[model samples]
Target: MKIALLGAESTGKSQLALALSAHLRNSGLAVHHVGEYLREWCDTHQRTPTQDEQHHIVQTQIARVMATPADTVVIADTTPLMTAVYSQLLFNDHSHDDLALVHQALFDVTLLTGLDLAWVSDGLQRDGPHVREPVDQKVRHMLSQANLPYQVVYGSGPQRLENALFCMGRQAPQWAKQLARQESPTRWSGLCETCGNGDCEHRLFTGLLVP
Candidate 1:
């Protein structure tokens, strides 16, 4: 199954994804961790492109990952929603059409790691010419408006990782546990019914189980 960890900058998304991957691996599950595409693409191109280009690159990376042949879990650090937020801020315009495309491109489950925890500003550089708070709020609103299936994870380090794990496991236990099983040779190359139909939000995030 594919899972995405999304949030604002310096919110520990990458660290959480890495920790979750390790935890799942220790439990004997094979997982493919997909890092942030925007950063990687920027490095490859040797120059940061406009927000529109970044949005396109994010979509392209997600499509590539979805098409990849993997037996177990595929955990993505960010998704198209984040790109849409960046686009909205940079372009001073938002499109329902673009948002629809992003909403349709996401995985069955998306876990939104929040910025409620203490801010660790180290290693956090100015991402292009954008400010942080506006970008963070834009992303939060995008996820909320899309009505995507997501859980708010709060904390730092292991606490944050544990919170994310619990949220994802609760929302998608079947898919999460399936990682422990043997990998299937056949991959889901095309978009699943849930992917294109926009119905995954209802089925995945409804009825949260309080621990």
Candidate 2:
């Protein structure tokens, strides 16, 4: 299953993704967590990206993750629609057209993760035209208008992660159960002995049958 966790800036999507991966791993499920695309793009370009650049960065990441092997359950930290919202709200550039293809590329599940969380004003600060609450509300409205199946995960820290994971686990597909049995038993440890690294930890197969 492909799951996208999306929200406005500083809404804890990254932390939630990491925590979910950790929790699932601890439960014995193998999961692959795809970090934020915007961060990758910024590192590659050696500078902060413009609004349009951000949109394309997210699109590229989505495409790459979607192309991953079928046995993997990808948890993308952000989605293209999020880039569109950020650009339109912060840069006054209505780049919704750029996201048309991306909108179509989304999988069966897109979990919107910032409905009840307070917005934080750090990292990539915005001013002038940016309005946090209204913009978030607008994003929620857009998702609803698109008829996307999404659940708002509220609360703070671990509570939010718990809520998000609970919602996602409930939506877990039946096919995932079969895939779990097929996965290598060692993959559930969230470790890579070859490179002696824990960064690419696997967490998907940890709890396929458990609630």
Candidate 3:
């Protein structure tokens, strides 16, 4: 199973990818995690890059995803579609090859990370909280236009993981199914009295963002 984690900045996409990979691996499943290549690029440069630099990042990300061994499940932190969205959103450059490649790319499932998660600023290339919704809309638009199989993951903490596992079908663990059955998630306050990610919802097999 190839799972693509798609979302805007600070939507928990990266963290979810890592968490899922770890979970599956711990379950004795083979999993390869495709890290965000842009992080390495930014770490090396010490600043955001120009439009030219973005092409390299996008292409590198695609290459990394492609190079991943897919005999087993592979979780991508962010797909090239995200790079295309960022390209259009930030540089206003949509003609790049990355957009075309991402549109053509296929995945067994694409989990659209909800914008209603805790925001973590990486302090360099990260955008502010205000752009989260708009960028999320853009990512959803791309997925819709491409006619991809996707679902919105709309919670944090355990609920968030359960939603994703449910979308993954049989790939989900027994515990994940149990959790999904026990708790009904709704759109919670961005922060909770105890768990900041409480009161969220699960939106599987949907085109909408679950809003």
Candidate 4:
């Protein structure tokens, strides 16, 4: 399974990617985690990339994922789609959108980290808490425009990991399922209605029930 994690800065994509990879590995699955190449690039260069550098960043990000061994479950912290979104957000460049979307469509599961997590500053990488909503909106808009299916993962700490696992049709731990069942149905109702996807609804409720 190729799982692509997408979201605005500080939404915990890196953490979730690591958690998912570890969890799957514990379950005896071969996992290959692809970290965000842009972060590495920025760190090495000591600054954010320019508008002209976005294409190379996008290419390197997707190329890493594509190079992963096929026998392993690929967990991509961020994909080229994010680079495209950032390009549009920062530079107003839309040239990379088509290429990014084409590659993103190949992922088996695209999980959008919810804005529920508090935004944290990350040196040159993170813009600010103010940009989170706009970036989130842009990501959703792009995915919708591309007719891509995605699950919005919401929660804190371990709960967030459980939510992600549920979205992927995998069984979460027993205690997590119990906690989910204890949650007010009203909470999930609003989300379900908002999503309007039968599969998402099924997955949401399924994680609440004992098998």
Candidate 5:
């Protein structure tokens, strides 16, 4: 199934996508985590994207999803509708952002992240903590208007994941079930061997630290 984690920025969508993908993969499920392409574009440009640039962000995201291996389940960090909603809020010129709804129908499930968590500024692209709630409302409004089936996930990081699984009518995978019983939150760990610093320590989202 194609499960999408979406909503306003810094709502733990990225971390949730990573955790969910990892959990599914551990369960012997073929999963592909389609990350947000706009993040890369913004980081490179060091500025919030213009309406024209936002289209490129959505287009690249579209291409990435299209390019995924057909047999694998997909967990997208954000749906294209996120772009449309943000576009309306930021540029006041959605510029075909509503077209994202056409693509939204393809997803098996969509999870909207809540704004109860901490917000961290990533760069010029972020609107910071204060803007999160209003943008979150916009996301909810847009999703409701489009008649999409979505579940709003809230709580601390681990609880949020459990909520998403429940919303999707899924139980925790074997590994996840085991992790949930553990007392030490830092028990889950991995290091990204490819990072140039060789210090890319990966931690499971036991709590929301940073995405």
Candidate 6:
């Protein structure tokens, strides 16, 4: 499964991505966690990317996912759709939306982090609490317009992780059950049998399952 995490700054996308990846890995699944490329870029440059640089950021984010091994579950901290949203909101440019949405269609699941968490300023990365709502709204509108399905994740810390797991469970019940129980060595068979994921089934048969 390719899981995409989306939301404005300070909404816990990075935290949840790591937590989810850890949980899945603990449950014996091969997982790849992709961090937000834009964050690294900002930290390296000591400033936000310009309008002209947004496209590069978007493409690089997508490239990270494309480069991941196909047999692993990809949990992306943030997808290119975010950069597209920022481009529209910050620079009023909509060019990146087409490519971002096209790439987003490949993901099996999308989880949008809710704005309920308190916003904390991150130097060079976060604009302010004020931009959160606008960014959130833009993200929602774009996803809705594209007719892409996404679950909204809310809460903090462990509660937040549970909520996300619940949402994921709704999509793949057997897989979620195995992760939640974290027991029963034979649970992988059930998850692979009922999850309807061919790659997962292939991994199981090929003895590539990671524990």
Highest TM-score, which number? 6
For residues 34-122, could you state the per-residue lDDT of candidate 5 as single tens digits? 98888887788877788777788888888888788989888998878888888887788767555788777778777877665678877
Candidate 2 residues 1-211, lDDT tens each? 6778766666678888888778666766667887777777666776668765665665687677776677666777876676677666668776663563355345655666543445565544333224655666666766667666666555566666655655564456563343343434331122211111123222221322238
Residue 125 alpha-carbon offset, candidate 5, angstroms: 3.0
What is the Cα-based TM-score of model 4? 0.82
Which 10 successive residues of model 5 have the least lDDT summed? 187-196
- Computed on alpha carbons, the lDDT of every model, listed in order, comes to 0.62, 0.60, 0.69, 0.81, 0.70, 0.82
Tens-digit lDDT track of model 4 for 1-211: 6889999999999999999899887867789999999999988999999999999999999889999998888999899999988898898899999999999889888888877666788899988999888898899899999998887887777777776777765322342242344444332332342232557656655664648
Better of 1 and 2 by TM-score: 1
TM-score result, candidate 1: 0.70
Between candidates 1 and 4, name the one with more favorable lDDT.
4
TM-score winner, 5 or 6 = 6
Off by over 4 Å in 2: 43-47, 51-55, 96-105, 115-118, 125-130, 173-211
| Per-residue lDDT of candidate 1, residues 1-211 (tens digit) | 6788777777778888899889888877777887877777767877766755765765676675676556777888776666666667667646433643464445766776654444555432345323656776666566566666666665556656655665676678876564443643232222221121234333333422324
The residue-by-residue lDDT of candidate 3 on 111-139, one tens digit each, is 88876666888877688998887888787
Q: Residue 108, candidate 4: how far off, in angstroms?
A: 0.6
Worst 10 residues of 4 by lDDT: 187-196
Q: Cα deviation in Å at residue 91, candidate 1?
A: 1.5
Backbone clash tally (model 6):
0
**Model 3: how far residue 11 lies from native, Å:** 1.0
Whole-model lDDT, model 5: 0.70
Pairs clashing in candidate 5? none
| Count of residue pairs whose backbone atoms collide, per candidate | 0, 10, 2, 0, 0, 0
Which TM-score value belongs to model 6? 0.83
lDDT of 2: 0.60
Candidate 5, residue 195: how far the Cα is off, in Å: 38
Superior candidate under lDDT, 2 versus 6 = 6
Q: Highest lDDT, which number?
A: 6
Give lDDT: candidate 6, residue 60: 89
